[model samples]
Target chain A: MTLQILLNLVIGMVWMLLHDEWNMLTFTIGYLIGMIFIFALRRFFPGRFYGIKIWSIIKLLLLFNIELVKSSLVVIGQITRPKLNIQPGIFKLETKLKSDWEIIMLTNMLALTPGSAVLEIAPKEGIMYIHAMDVAEFKQSIVRTKDLFEEAIIEVMR
Target chain B: MNVSAIIEIIVAVMVLAGTVLSLLSSLGFIRLPDIYTRSHAATKSVTLGILFILLGTFIYFWFMHGLISIRLLLGILFVFLTAPVAGHLVIRSAYRSGVKLSDTSVKDELRDDLKKMKQLEQYHSKEG
Candidate 1:
């Protein structure tokens, strides 16, 4: 645990330095303070330090970027065209994911994707109500989207 | 513009775009009629906006320092993990609290399930 704290501090400093936004002293101080908060709450949390599954998270980041790029183009195209061709609707998706962390990950991913938003999630029933700007396309694609992203979350967190 | 100046401009543009998107999403939060609609704005728009900001940061760091540190990656990771969870909690709470939808809302399967459950409860009570 102490080692993890030290590692986090070191990593934080490197991050601050790389960004070239904050001075070294400020970064170090902030890093120390942040680590203290993490250390203090370490035992209260479960699953890898801070409850993050690292490799799975990396995969998610990659997937998110890909989706973002794809959605950006789609959205930009829609904006440029004359007609505002959107079929907006809210749909309920049944998710098999159980943990709070997993559900959160899934919704965030959904929200980030172009033309979709996670309106509400009922964790007790594993249901998520999502609004899609292009509901017709989403309906056709949702199963694949959930299978890809939500399944990854289930594997990582559960 | 010099290479550094151009990079800075690009980063600034990205940041500004992200900020605008975030604000728009917040507006959606307020303007959207129902809890479900509001949540949609809050979650999706915010996530995309944040991603843009992070991407800008990542690019700025890569250009300025010549190396991609794990820390920025971690920040991205943290946002990705927490944003959805927060959305989920809000939605779940809304559902449990009995927030109703607009009349135009079609095909409420969850409501149907709840109705079936109530009927089952009544039947069991009569038998008992």
Candidate 2:
């Protein structure tokens, strides 16, 4: 990814120098031209263009932030209530993610969202032990959230 | 209030909210039943709190001083990346060392699986 970005930057610079224009507009036009060229010769590249991956990454981050806000509110509500009546427990979840990077990302995202924290992983078993603050209430929601997150993570990692 | 004042107020509000959330996370440490739940409080609430605080600071600098601070942006990103991992590590070690769950815990679905895995490991070792 970094290599692709550097190549694009170099192309943009070369285009600007050729036109003798040292301006943002010149650089942008050069960048777009380089992007098209890269797209045309994409089969020669080892991986997808850096731009597409970056967009997916941004989408994942956005989904993460949205979950963060939503779960934070839920936690705050639980905290401020007059009674502490949460039933926390550890539950087993089967993870569809195969790669270490994807699993790491999913676990971190899960931990940051309220109610669920990854307690342990059985890598060979493809399972995770997740502790949820209110297990009964959160079981279904957690599964839903995990599916959403898994889909987003796969979109980004693939 | 003028536009600049309004922006300042927004920044102040965000910072205040973040501070409150951080305090709530600390309160969770006191009120929560055990290590697992406390870790959840620490990871989620505190992370969101710091994110909010840093983001407000970023916006304040960008809008009020017209200076884009890369440090604040990186701080936000690093906090997001590291906080949960740290929390996870702490809780995992605690569990491995045989910390007992609180009485209020409704179930432990992982326990049987973990035991079965241990038995399998022992059996494999015996065969080898």
Candidate 3:
């Protein structure tokens, strides 16, 4: 991914030099041209083009922000309710993520979203212990969120 | 009325919303049942609140002063990266040190897994 970005930047610079226009617009056009060129010859590269990974990352961030807002609202509601009716608990999450980076990403995302916090990760067993504000309410959604994040992480990583 | 005025209005709204969200998060911290849930409030809403506030500042500087502040952008990024991790670590340590969940808590699923893990560790040590 870094290589692709470096090469694209070099291509953009070269295009600007050729056009004798060192402006933002010229450089952006050059970058787009280089992106397309890179996409076409992506098979020669060791991995996926950086643009796809970048897009996946943006999608992941967008998903996280949306989830954050939704969950924050729910938490606010929970806090302001006349009577607290929460059933908090610790639950085991069996994660499909194998690598340290992906596991860490999932852990962090889980911690912030939808009334959950990570307690511990048993990497050997591929299990994470999550503490949920309302275990019954969040169980199904937690699995769905995990799958959503796992897919997004795989897109960026694999 | 003008573009700069409109931008200032937006910045004001953003900052206000951010402040409200942060206030709600602190409310959550105070009212939540346990350390785990409290950390949730501390991490998620607070991060979003700070993000909104920083973004508002960034936009304000860009439009009002014609200056794009890298510090504001980096501050937003840093909060996004660190808040959840900090919350997670705090909760993890609290749990590891055997903090009890609230009475309202429905279940403790990790206890069985932890017991099995401890037994495995003991078995390994005995063999060694």
Candidate with the greatest DockQ versus the true structure: 2
lDDT by residue (B1-128, candidate 3, tens digit) is 89998999999999999999999889888898888788888988888899889999999999999998999999988888898889888987887789888899888988887888889999999999
**Cα displacement (Å) at residue B109, model 3:** 0.8
Pairs with steric clashes in candidate 2: none
**Candidate 1 lDDT tens digits, A11-103:** 677768776778877687667666666667777654346325556767876887787656545544444445545455667888988877777
Q: Distance (Å) between predicted and true CA of A42, model 1?
A: 36
For A99-123, candidate 3 gives per-residue lDDT tens digits of 9999999988887788888888999
TM-score of each: 0.57, 0.90, 0.93
List TM-score (chain A only) for every prediction. 0.63, 0.85, 0.92
Better of 1 and 2 by DockQ: 2
Write model 2 residue lDDT over A41-119, tens digit each, in one string: 7788888877788788899889899999988888888888889999999999998999999999999999977589999
Q: Where does the lowest 10-residue lDDT sum fall in candidate 1 chain A?
A: A72-81
Note the Cα lDDT for every prediction shown.
0.68, 0.90, 0.88
* Candidates 1 and 3, the one with greater lDDT: 3
Q: Is candidate 2 or 3 superior in TM-score? A: 3
Fraction of native contacts under 8 Å reproduced by each candidate? 0.19, 0.75, 0.78
Ranking by lDDT: 2, 3, 1
